[model samples]
Target: MICKAKAQWIGYPPGSDTSKAWRTGDVVIGGAAPQNAKLTVTGNIVQTSNNNYFNTARLYMQSPGAIPANGQTYATFAGNTFWNNDSAKWQIANSDLTHFGMMRFSATGINFYTQTAATSAQWLTETDLASMLALTMQRGGNVGIGVPVSQAKLHVGGNGSPIDTIAQLSANMVIQASTGGRTTDRGAQLEFVLPSYSNGTNFWGQGRIITVAGDNIHGNAVGKMIIGTRRKFNKLGTGSDWYYGDDIVIDGKGNIGIGTLTPSKKFTMAYSGTQLNSTTPITSEMVVQASTATRSVDTGVALEFVLPANTDGTNLYGHARIFAQAANNTNGNAAGKLVLGTRRKYDKIGAGSLWYYGDDITIDETGNVGIGTLKPTGKLAVNGILLAKQVKVSQSAANWPDYVFTPGYQLPSLDSVAQYISENKHLPEMPDAKEVETNGQDVGKVQQLMLKKMEEMTLYMIDMQKRIDRLENENRELKAKSNNQH
Candidate 1:
């Protein structure tokens, strides 16, 4: 156990005869010579000066001169005025010196345990040294000035039993586990029971003291907490897609946020204070949006919207939504094929002639085919249904054979006289290659009488003869007939 001395026998400059002091093979105070000394102890010593008065304080370790190579020094000291002058004191050689404590320059009387013979060395192992330190701290009791805990208790067994030993624990006492824990009838058990609260006032180790139900505080305060500068909240990497100071407020089931907290919401460019203000909503808005600038939408292939060269594995392989423009086989052997399947015999679009066993080429309702829009110019080559309308091969092949019209096809711009002349003029069998006959019928009245005689003449010869004679006489005879008939 530690031996404590206050040295309260005040004297002029604190003087006393060193001969009155105690000496041991392990410890030495002011020694047998006359010096300023009093109340010396050879064993573990706990000494404290009162009112900051200490003079000619000295301590020395007189271990053997020879120390083992690579040997360690174990020591501990702590005090406001603690100092040491051991810079040039250690002698290193081939002997062991372990477990030295308190080599401060200010504190005097180093306490130690050593071999009685000066030639022999005494050293404590780690466990022994630790035990001695515990014992010393336990015997020292409470210095009891400013330490948080003034006293502690060491219990061996049951509570409040007279047989159970209770030792007063010092304020600075650090009691270590003797052998870690204890073994009982119920295997190895570690039982820790906290001291009961002496008064109605609560203590932290038992019940809760002051709990922070909501926020403890807001804004920045010194030492209150600054989630260290090295620590980051949103750890978005060094890409351009990261945003900071954007807050996300979530409800019990929903979320109303300044910046979009949910993936289906929008984000606003505006910010309120350090927080982002909720204005616009972003459903599919991506921070790093990827799109196909060439086409209006993204096609999941590596190819651009327009390609310079066909990207076939070896030959010409088109990817998704593959399109061919003016693509044809040079030899016309139909070796050019668009594949849309794995390596197996399958239909691409369609095959030749009638009984083609292949996929059907479909025209969508919007008139688009394959993967894009289809626009026909001049004529559209259709493979599906065709609606038909009647067309005349020759307009001169009339309502009846006797009703011969001159110009084969009637033009839309033909006037009344022109239409009559065209209808009455005897058209040549090949009007396309021959001149049309426009003579002898009254061109003006021909529009009226043309239909009347068109039904009257049943014989082809009579019709031809009458028209030819009328043409031979020209309009001079035609006008007389018109007037007489009228």
Candidate 2:
């Protein structure tokens, strides 16, 4: 029944007892006037019905103008609230004016109740709210999924646990900026701004911003991306300051850098340390492997080098590759060959068109290394002149020229040596000038032959000295005999 004016009723209606105050009808206590009527209920407004429609009571506030800001000016409930009793308990205060628009449910103990939205079975029920309340009480702080928990802020998971905690999605998860037209502005980014502390004083810390768009992961910063520490002064009165360097960085073009921010290649590393002093050989720093069997196809692990074009720009610099071939035996007879060379086009000697150059250095299955040739004839074959500071050739006893000084060695006569030199234009057992001009001298063999000639010439000089001594004695005796005859 609608009560439009002031009405005071002290007693219960008809057959209703004090336990059942007013039975069976919708009750409206206020009038249509703006703020004229007031309704005060000394007892609890209870609803006890099995019917689904009218089994609930709602305190609906309707205002023509602005509602009062003070919650007490509106409806208030003051009682010991019980939910499915003994399961949860809380106290409500109508006089709590500071918290104006909020519903206060101060738990009587560790137990509390909360209501969720209506469903098909019930208007309101304790869905997961009870569990949520338990978690809040247990954690003693706010709960978050993707941030850190602070004194007042309830940030979600701080250590990457949120990803695992979230339900798996069937499709890709795209966090785009807008749902509209495709543009360069569409991307996802995560930023971190941490606070730094020194001696209990807080300072502005470094910030790192990571963005993902298309196929790139970009790292950015407003100022320097790295921060260093300052240490106390030492005995020399010099304060030690650590160098600021990039810990890790990757550009949009898939270039990765370690200890450097600007990487010019696919992967670049910059580091400073003392050279290893150990006598043992060290292992390789990096290794690239291709395990696929692509003998029929042209595929392998290649370390490619591409340099910029020249100033004229008429011809771009060609690529050079050091590659370990797969099973392909196209260039050589064997498979799995190791090749190092450029791919620059060169005019074939007796061919029609230009062809790509072959390997500058190649190693065959037999462990023979070749330079400037794919097929090697020996253990090491160089197609060009080899310049070296020194060359030591191992010689056997019979191969060495030390036999020239042996006791039974046969030395040619000086006259015969001179006759051979006059006829051949060279020393005995030595190549002539024409032969030397045609073929380059073998350094080791040439030195041995020269040493032999010098040893033979020493024997000739000794024989000449003995003949001169005998002639001098003969001359002295002849002079003495001539003096006696006189």
Candidate 3:
């Protein structure tokens, strides 16, 4: 079955049709003739795959009820009944938006309701749409890539889920810096910029994050990240514009470098792009690496913590330090020593010099520790006062004073003891004042000698007691004979 009809309507020159006269059956269809044959009506056509007729069940736009004071006509959206629907009341008004000093247009702006409003009176009318909308290449707007609505300045949603987690694929952006050919690629740098005051059109980068190929080889692209900031100076620019300098770096080896690109340890804080093995030093460096070669005795690493005299950062004194150095300058047999030192500050009357600094504790290579002295002669040495609740001294049986109670032990007579003390001006077997002063007294040795003296005093007291007892017995015998004679 084939049916064909050709119809054309054309108005005369300078003629128009403004008539709203009733026109319903102007285009009608009947029977099977209208089923297969295609009747095309000229309008803004939305393409349908099957090329079918559109059902006119939905209502068209309502007439404008009244003109507002702004001389704008508003109409309710067609077929809007449900709340939170894809419906918006539209109007045409004079454009008054002014931004960037370019051409301004206002009739193209749109608005919608996001909240639940049951009726027309419950709707909150928005008089401005520029603040809510994220325009493309326009001011007062945010840009969203692959996002239905964006809340940030720039929201990018990438396609083809780069990760296995489906829920997390909602807001994610991945950047890949690759060279199409077999060439070394400098990794991508993302810069945060701000409009410069010198020129509104130009922008200056304030900070940047750069990702680099960890291995310089073409195919092997281990990732290294650098986060940098722009300071007052630039690459030969006179403080007008600035470039980025690396402030922190994380290499592919999982080493974090705070001030240097190459970190030797798991976490390294080098100063001014240089490590501790370098001779040249920067003035503003907080961490220092001294000279490596030609290093002499007492030369190694020293981390000093200094305290300022006042809030002005002047008269700084080295308050404390963790210092390690080679005690002996010999090549292979260099004795390493770790020293803990504290600087003591003294308040002067008028003008006194000298901030005091001395080693509070030291540990040497031979495992000898010195409390107040750097050079320790024993396993434990203290040059200051030692306080303890109890002390134990171990001595051999021959050295102990318990030998005094033995029968074979020689106990000096009282006459001999008196003579010996009068001659020596000090106790026998005890160190004199001069010797004790010159060489510090050993606690264990002194305690042993004192015990020996105490034991000797006990023996002399026993001998005197025996002599008194003999005298008493002789007197008693004499008195008994006298009484018998009387």
Best by lDDT: 3
Q: Sort every candidate by TM-score, greatest first.
A: 3, 2, 1
Which lDDT tens digits does candidate 2 get at residues 1-486?
323322432345677665433233333333333233345444455644556787565544333222333442332234322122111222232243221111223342133323323321221234544332321221454443322222443332222324434343222333334424332323343333344565655544244333323222243211112222222443233567422224555665667776566668887777664366643343334567666564534566777776655676555555687877643456533445677887655632434456464578878667789887767766676777888898787667787878877898888988898899888877878877777666646666888888788878787888788998999999999999999999
- The lDDT per prediction is 0.31, 0.51, 0.60
Candidate 1 lDDT by residue in tens digits, 422-469: 876642222321222322223224433454344333334555789888
- Candidates arranged by lDDT, highest first: 3, 2, 1
C-alpha lDDT (0 to 100) for residue 428 of candidate 2: 79
Which one wins by lDDT: 2 or 3? 3
Output the better candidate (1/2) by lDDT.
2
lDDT of 2 at 476: 93
Residues 344-383, model 3: lDDT tens digits: 6543222346675567788988989999887888888898
Give the deviation of candidate 2 from the true structure as CA RMSD.
17.4
TM-score of each: 0.19, 0.37, 0.40
Q: Name the candidate, 1 or 3, with the larger lDDT value.
A: 3
Q: In model 2, what are the clashing residue pairs, if there are any?
A: 145-156, 145-157, 146-156, 147-155, 147-156, 147-157
List candidate 1 segments past 4 Å from native: 1-15, 18-22, 25-244, 247-258, 261-486
Best by TM-score: 3
